[model samples]
Target: MRELVFALDYEPGCNTVADALAEHPAARVRSLSLHATADRLWRVDHVTGTHEALDAIEDAFLTSDYYADCLATEDCGATQTTRVLDRADNTLVLYSDWERTPACDSVPHIAQDNLGDGVLFETRHEGRHYTWRLIHSGEGDVAAFFDDLAGAVGESAGMEVLRTADTTASMRGSNGTQSSPSPEQEAALRAAVEHGYYESPREVDVAELAEHLDVPRSTLTYRLRRAEEQLAKQYVAGRLVTDEASISR
Candidate 1:
């Protein structure tokens, strides 16, 4: 798993990124996501199919201020971080802004397509720069090995990571061994269910939600899905949805 952490100077516009990649017909949109805080700094993480294609995408890529910063962190290796003792309050996020979930061989495409994305919000722990990252790419999974890494980081810090990840996909009903979430995640889960956000809002322009909320559309989606996950914990307890949504089936 190649994990790179850097900062960007632009806003997150996945559609633009998608359109940019679409310029290369052979390359298709894989997955795109955005993370942000009120401070205005933006993180856009996207993975797409390899073009056997773009000869100049890299040129267009590294030229960006964001990509430039990311290249500087190539030497940073937090991929195999193990636990010594960790923090319980620490939160990790699985930024799965992928499209196809490519195979291992396709990891390169993921790396290549996401030229300016994959920013990790991390903190230093015992001298090592611990980060939230993926262990594998293009494994046909939208939400990849986030929990394992979170656990690893917690163990390393000698404290259990309670949230595991800041954003995660909870089982609607019986997906993992863990119990459901607390009332907070539970309420978010209920809102998600009542709003039809999880079943894929038939006509929801998710981007629009951001417009209304005055947040980046990416932010809306993240919060929306995250809330869904919280509710899903209840759906988990209550046996909502179908077996299709359960990872433990």
Candidate 2:
């Protein structure tokens, strides 16, 4: 198996959800599950943001051509349905089903058409960038697919390849049995580190980071704390396991 990782940057008005994400820069979407056939696609997505941002995103999804039935109403031979599976103060889970037609083309459709069956997809959307990870049997013409997608998107979107590698090797290199951080936690952690929030002198504080990220102080603090706790636990667990193995040897 092979993994193809790529990212797409969408301009405003190019993609409905992308536009919404651009408008609400702090909001993020991560695909929890996705499956696509020739004629249909089903997905479950987890989103995180402020309440206002989530509300706007939900509205865009339900009313736009991306996740709702607008195409069917327009007699485009396509149908879509979406609903909120769960909601919290700063998080939302959405489920969507789409019956595709030639008139409506999506990333999943393009990938399925070019990569063939048994391809697994993982995706993350933040701001105007959508990143994808595809696991396939390495039988597809990746370069041709990339060109096709680039032409399909035209000038409204930009695409780039991030990585390509053996799926098995990638899996083996992953942290063993450690729960990975969620999108929100990972974003916060990354931002904190980049901004020197964890430096000895603490170049930036939580409130300042929150302001820079445009999120509430409480939300940023909570995310940072959770991320820190998770990392600490993982480090200790790994050390203990290593020590035990050394003693046995």
Candidate 3:
């Protein structure tokens, strides 16, 4: 099995979210996750910048031609629901349960058709460009997949494969342990630490770190937090194992 990460760029107004993001230079969609629950039901998570941008994004979704219906949205700052639709903050994490139209021509649909069951894990919008990470089983020709996708989107779409790698053995550690963060998470953590994110003076802020990583600020923040949590858990588990061994001795 093989894992591939794809970075794709789309034209302006390609979809409602992309169009809304294009209008706000300071606010971008940091990351998005899509899960198809049923025939047309999909749960989507969108991490966006700025409350104003979130409002615009919500508007786009409500009026999008791709989704047949917007099932529901949680009001912002509400702790009751998993959806955060009305968040009036600098960075907003919006969750929506909706249904896609049968004839949807969104990027997700295009990717699903061309990439075969690949997971659209991460996406970031910056300066009218969209970068996406797709992971799928390596059972087909990568070149052929790219060709088909490019042809489907056309030359004007600016489709570029920024990076690709085979991550089949990435889960296994040298000690046969499986307690490491993902490559992307590790990279984010390493960059954050190297930039003095944890320093007393704080040499680098989240915004700077995001810029350095070439990702949205919210994306970096989410990665760093997750990586730290994972590492902390691993450390605690290791210490507990050592203590148990000493007690037995």
Measured against the true structure, the TM-scores of the candidates, in listed sequence, are: 0.30, 0.68, 0.51
Tens digits of lDDT, candidate 3, 113-218: 5555644456665544566666667655677667666664563355645446555453443223435676777899889889999999899998899899987554
15-117 per-residue lDDT for model 1 (tens digits):
1222344344333222223332211222232223343323223333323222211212122221111111211222211132212211111222333334223
Least accurate 10 contiguous residues by lDDT in model 1: 78-87
Writing each residue's lDDT as its tens digit, candidate 2 over 1-249 gives 899977776666766777787778789999999988888888999999999889988887787655431222234566778899999999999998888887766666677778778899898877767778899889878887787777766776667675678877667535454455657778999999999998999999977998999865545654676567768878887898899999999
Top candidate on lDDT is 2
Clashing pairs in 2: none
Q: Model 3 clash pairs?
A: 76-86, 76-87
What are the RMSDs of all candidates, in order?
Answer: 16.9, 7.0, 9.0
Each prediction's total of clashing residue pairs, residues at least 3 apart in sequence or on different chains, is: 17, 0, 2
